[model samples]
Target: MKAILLIGHGSRAKEAKDVFIKVSNGLQERVKSKVYIAFMENATPSIEDAFVSIREDGVRYVDVLPYFLFEGIHIKEDIPEILREMKEKYDVEIEFKRPIEYHELIIDILIDRLKGAGICI
Candidate 1:
């Protein structure tokens, strides 16, 4: 089976965790493939744990999607490094997708947030 792993830069704040959970749930509903959420730090279900879950679910390939806005250190270096290690250890093949900022929909979402906050842009 194929799976999607949504990687987020975990936050200490409860609200941040809530948001990730909600988004992951939403994606799980919309996509045909299985979707799993994992954090880089400051949260539960680390990447390794997520990989284990994916493997347990009989996932043979995964498309890792970083739930980030930009190509920051986590996107460019940290995630890839972890993925490299996971690929070596697991029986599954994995690849990383570009951050959300690479998508045109992000502009629409940003504009919606700005408008909701009464910030005309």
Candidate 2:
């Protein structure tokens, strides 16, 4: 089956990790595909670890979706590098999606957050 690996720059805060997992679960429901979440650092499941779990579950194709907003080093270099290694080790078809860049929908979400913080722009 096709699977999705949601990648996040793991945070030390429990709340951040919790939010990531919640989003992953939601995505799994919406996409109807097996979804796995992993962190680049400071998280329990690393990319390699998550890959192993999904591979064992018979997932042959993986869409490595980055839960990032910017195209920083992590998005550009780190993820690709890790995915290359994982592909070699697991022999799976892996595709990396770029970070969610600026968009009107993102702007709407930002405005909502700002309004909630009592800071109207």
Candidate 3:
């Protein structure tokens, strides 16, 4: 079976982690495939832990969706390296989805936020 692992750069704030989990749960309800959430640091359910859970569910393939906005060091180096290790250790096929970078929808959202803030944009 296939699963989607949403990876977020963990924050020290509890609300950040909670938001990630909430988003993951909402995604689980919307999609047919299994959904899971993991953090890079400062949080529980690390990437490997999530992989173990996925393996337990007999999910052989995982789509790693990084909840990052740009191709930072985590997206460029750290995440891929960790995923490579996880792939070998768990014996699961892993594929990465690109970070959210430069999309028209993002611009639309920014404009909406600005308008909501009474920026008159």
List the candidates' TM-scores in order. Answer: 0.90, 0.94, 0.94
- Model 2 clash pairs are none
- Arrange candidates by lDDT, descending: 3, 1, 2
lDDT tens digits by residue: candidate 3, 18-45: 8988989999999999998999999988
lDDT by candidate, in order shown: 0.92, 0.92, 0.94
Alpha-carbon error at 36 in model 2, in Å?
Answer: 0.4
Best by lDDT: 3
TM-score of 2: 0.94
Clashes of each: 0, 0, 0
Pairs of colliding residues, candidate 1: none
Worst 10 residues of 3 by lDDT: 112-121
TM-score of 1: 0.90
Cα RMSD of all models vs. native, in order, equals: 1.6, 1.2, 1.1
